[model samples]
Target: MTTPTAKRWEIVDLIANRTVTAGEYKPSIKDYLSELTVKPLTGIPVALAVLYAFWSIFSSFAGALVTDGFMVKLFDNYWLPWIQNVWPNPDSVLYFLFVGDPLADNCFEAFGMLTSGLFVSIGVVLPAIFIFYLMMTILEDSGYLPRLAVLMDGLFHKIGLHGYAIVPAILGLGCNVPAVTATRNLETKKQRFIMMVLLAVFIPCGAQLGIMLDVIPETVGWVMLYLIIGFCLFGFILGKLIPGGNPEILIDIPPYRRPALQNICKKLWVKTKGFFINAIPFVLLGILFVNVLYLLGVIQALADLFAPLFVTWFGVPKETVGPLIAAFLRKDLAVAQLSTIAMTPYQMITAVVLISIYFPCVATFVVMLKEGVKELAAAVGVLAVIVFLYGGLIHLIGILLGVA
Candidate 1:
């Protein structure tokens, strides 16, 4: 027996009749706000306000209330002293590695696996990342992120990314490991590579941001300004250079809703737990590794060897070599190490910016590698070029301003 096949229009009409229903739609406040957030006229100012609030809350709660107000005092006054006094033989290798400088009064200068490591990871970074994740969770759960992405689509396309590229960029601010993975959401290999390279080089993780605020609050703004400029400039250049299809953005904008407390707490817990498991060990190990390098005279030799280039080209002290090494493991640790170095404010700014742009932390590197080895190599090559060119450009600007 032969079955009769419905015509294409008839099939579509049958499906529509069975699945679609007509109803009177009434727009609510949520609809109005969603439209407002995606429109250029209203969205830009709202975005600015949202970002300003995010920064203010981040700096105030994490930097001021928690780290500066609580954790710093506890670690510096109590923990450092107790560990220093109890640990045997201040000159002993173990003591130096574990407890750091016995005479050092603060945790920041202690530079031990236990002292500075714990302080940097817990005291500074923990609070910063906790608050960051909390706010990020709220933004995500409330359905603001996609709308923000829509609003940013136009600018993102200028750099060869769609609006959704903001997902990885924002996530990169927390940790580039996840951000590197988040790039998988992009449509093209070119988009993923550019986003990975840009985030790895320019977006300072929350841990690093916390340390920057604590260590170089005066010049952190300058460092961020340089980073932003580099991100846009290099992103634009790479977009044009890399052969790829720059497809138009297609995204679903969900209606804004009240974020659930349960979901927010769960996400916060997951992210915080990941940070504790992954980041703390790296911070501690980075301190230990750098200390061992110092003991073996590797750092000193590197400083001496690189002094000419650092002084002339980068216009910063070569002592930055130590922090650069630490930066490979954990950038927050690197920034903490940088704080102990003696440099002028401009030099400090330059060194911090260099540390940020020089390379991704080991975790980020691993994730990028997971994406593709050839891509990783290409990204690294691009990174090397950026470091030399952008670092020199910054130095030239500083020289013109008589600051370098």
Candidate 2:
């Protein structure tokens, strides 16, 4: 060890096994890029640009080419027709389940496991899932996400959440189930509850985003913008409303490095495979549940039951009641159901918005309950109020913007 009185410039160079005085090298591209991401003045813009690029690639390009161009044609032109041709009887449960009422002129109207199920699951959602995960994995592997968390630390601090809360928020974009579990990373019960509530209410998972992009391509950005704004605003509101002391962020930021292709592919495959494995069954089950409800005339009963709430208050059709119920099982499927309904853009926007905020899926609900029963109950109550309030108010916003 060096003496306490040693001069600062006389430090030892034992690691290199030499008495080297100093070393110097020019800053590399990675260092320059790091500077751009860490500085407050430039970091936010860079983050926005990066997000915009990912959105364009996921929503516009993959959505248009893979989901719309390929999946839509495959589903509508081939899959639905083939299934319908084989099961043509209007009165049969099989026919109705696979080919819905033939009156509505859209694939979503069919609501079959092979028709809308295949269409929404394969056509619209698959591309979005793949692209969003691909970009997300890239970001994760590159060490940029931590830098982003650092950059947003100030804003998150004001919300009574630390920058690390961004982890669950980012995870939520992939799937809310895991995201809810991720809230355990927070130090306090109140923080976990707040994070869970905000995520469940505002953050649209990748699968939901995928279908939304496919159906309402032009308005997805605006819809996403609304949700993102709600995320921060509600986080701050919850910070104040809930009794808790805001904690300072403690995180480690790693140097930027090129992501390995093999690791990226492995992670991408694992996440996407998990989503498909978990979500597809729920999608199919939702279709079957909808069919059973329809056959029993329960759908009409539900439609009537929620008509005043969904139709009068939210400005969406009463048929949305089925999708709203489906949301309890799977939100992406609920969003998929919107494609079949006849509605103005305003109605569709409100429907998607409500679907996102109405409630967490069964998986997330269980996780939240496991985290804290009382808190989960409070969260459920809050969800009810928000779903109705935001769902109704968005229509007015859409009308004022003249998009309705």
Candidate 3:
């Protein structure tokens, strides 16, 4: 063999024979699912079905089963009555601050730090977020989220973002605080800013969603329609106006695998822990702050002053001012408060939408500030304009539809 010089082709074939080993390949079900989820033809309907299931489970388990069937009865029938009787001195400032209205029948009407705060945080929001995080974790660990991102990439690009933007958008539905941080995954400053603003304005947190299902279940669909419209409309405008590069990104889609129970439990625990530490305090403090403002006559004064703007422009009542103020601290609490106010169904819809879009909760605002004070300032400015324009636009739509 050494005596005979080998041709280059023969040497190349010898190397290939040693290196490459061909085998029969059979596609697995996981492979078929992966393809079905990423392609446009099949993926869109699958995405719709998945989201519908998500919403259905979130509403039924969190809203109906846990909160309505259990928490409502527990808090309203037993807890509220017991607290009302035992809290001592219903007339005292401390009593009012902690227990709210002396004769109120339910936790939602109580408005006290200890009464409504605990109820809203534990009874309503906790279940909602738990279910949301559970489903979200399942979607994430099963390797479906990346495929969702890929499917959404084309639509998102029209708004100056890649497919990955859906991650933050979905996160925002649970809570905007984490969603603001999630924007770091975006490639450019403009994308982050747009995402932050959109999240702050358009996406209602799980707490709000839970309460909405409880309070305005019939009209929640309309409210959501308006929000989705605003999200895309402003996103497109920002994509055109903002000065930054929207670059393409490479997404690494992992093979489908069974989500490990240990991993899901770990993620769920971490998320629940975050909500307890970051959100519960705010819910309690929000009630306290609003109560103090009420006692100080600030809420009444502001309501009187804003009566013209709120009534004339937003097509909502001046009383919405109080809830709007509370909204700064917690939008869910504000929505709950809004339910107590007297308004036409249309006005109620507008007021709730206003509360949803007006400003990010203090927690979200703080996180945005941490991202960059300058960015925060700019976001606030954009928010102000969006509130004015979009609020008026909704009112205008209502007027055209004869609903305002």
**Alpha carbon lDDT of each predicted model:** 0.93, 0.80, 0.94
lDDT of 1: 0.93
Pairs in steric clash, model 3: none
Q: Which portions of model 3 show Cα errors greater than 4 Å? A: 1-20
lDDT of 2 by residue, 211-304 (tens): 7777677667677777877777777877888897767777778889889999989998997888788877777778888788878989899899
Alpha-carbon error at 163 in model 3, in Å? 0.8
Model 3: lDDT of residue 311: 89
Q: Which lDDT tens digits does candidate 1 get at residues 242-279? A: 99888888888777889999999999999999999989
**lDDT score of residue 88 within candidate 1:** 79
Best candidate, lDDT-wise? 3
Which consecutive 10 residues in model 1 have the weakest lDDT in total?
A: 1-10
> In candidate 2, residue 81 scores what lDDT?
70
lDDT, residue 256, model 1: 83
The true-versus-predicted C-alpha distance at residue 118 of model 3, in Å, is 0.8
Deviation in Å, model 3, residue 120 alpha carbon: 0.5
